[model samples]
Target: MKQKTIGLLGGCSNVATAEYYRFLNEAVNTRLGGWEIAETLIAGMNFGNIEAFVRTGDWDGLGRYMKTKIDGLVAGGADVILCVSNTLHKPLEDLMDRGGVPMIHIADPTGVAMSAAGLSKVAIFGTKPVMEMSYLKDQFQHRFEVQAIAPTEEEQCDIDQIIFDELVKNKLKDTSKARYLEIADRMRREEDAEGLILGCTEIFLLIDQDDRPDFPMFNTARLHCEAAVDFALS
Candidate 1:
């Protein structure tokens, strides 16, 4: 069989895109036990335009824009597609509906990971849309008995600022790091969350195991990459 080329739809920001690429490559190389990396096709879109479409919730415009990218991936011989951004998945569903490509659902892999972890309740941290919407929650609840929890109103604002102003912009501030740990502590104490889900790919930029030693932190980026590795190798 030919080596599968995974198509990555990135550009929520360069950092998260970099993380996805690094994670996928690392996982493939480690598993294969050689210098060979996963074959990938990436089309990094304009972040400004992506932000505009997301802010307006313009599914039609988003779908059209993504279709052009998907077409390019097909032309580049990508066998499967994966969107690196959680927020972009809003538009991705529509694009996949029209693009006729087998696109991987990034959240589904994370859902499976959560199931494997045996977590009954997990704290989900991400953008407002992801936190408010049923898409991610439904995926987790249906696959596992996982109940997703979010930060408090104040904590949400802080997280939003950290992600947008700091993490996305590639400035990981110490204050933002502290805030995330504080939020994680509260999630465990108040919400009784069994673990934390870094639902946003950019989140790994600011927080990690050092911040939340008390609970297992599931990095969605790593989980998504592992799933891609399995799919590609399978």
Candidate 2:
């Protein structure tokens, strides 16, 4: 069987994309039981452009720019493309409609995992844009038949700050991680969430199951990379 080449649009934080690269290659090697790694192509994007689009509400312009960039990856032999950012998944359809390459959505795998685990509800952590955007949450809810919930207004602000201020810069503070854990607990208690989603690719840097052993945590970057590698090897 021929392996599909994985193409990635990364650097939404630079940190997240790097994690995706690591996780995808690691997963491929583990599954193949050798030094095997994915044949990957990456088209990096500046975080500034993404922020500008969100700030200025110029999604159309952002879509055009991403579509053009992804075209480069497709031309370079990318069989499948991954946007690689939870926030950027908002403009996902625009790029996918180009029909140049098959695009892997970030939330789809999470939804699938949730459904398989019989989790009825999950709380997501990410930037303001990711939390505010209902499309991603809807995909999880409608497609997987699970309730996808976001943080409270205060929690959203803090999580957004943690992603932009510390996580993106590769900084890790136990205090901030603890705060995130607290919020997840609140979601479980108040909303009856069965699991937690580290939706922002950068969030996995600070929090994981190690910190909260009792809680079921879904690391989006890791899960997305696993899905990418599965597609490549399929």
Best by lDDT: 2
TM-score of each: 0.94, 0.95
TM-score for candidate 1, residues paired by index: 0.94
lDDT of 2 by residue, 106-200 (tens): 88898888888889888989888888888788888788888778888999999988888899889999899889989999999998988898888
Per-model CA lDDT versus the true structure: 0.83, 0.86
Residues 106-145 of candidate 1: C-alpha lDDT, one tens digit per residue: 7888788878878889999987767777778877888777
Number of clashes recorded per candidate: 0, 0
The root-mean-square deviation over C-alpha atoms between each candidate and the true structure, in angstroms, is 1.6, 1.4
Clashing pairs in 1: none
Q: Candidate 2 local accuracy as lDDT?
A: 0.86
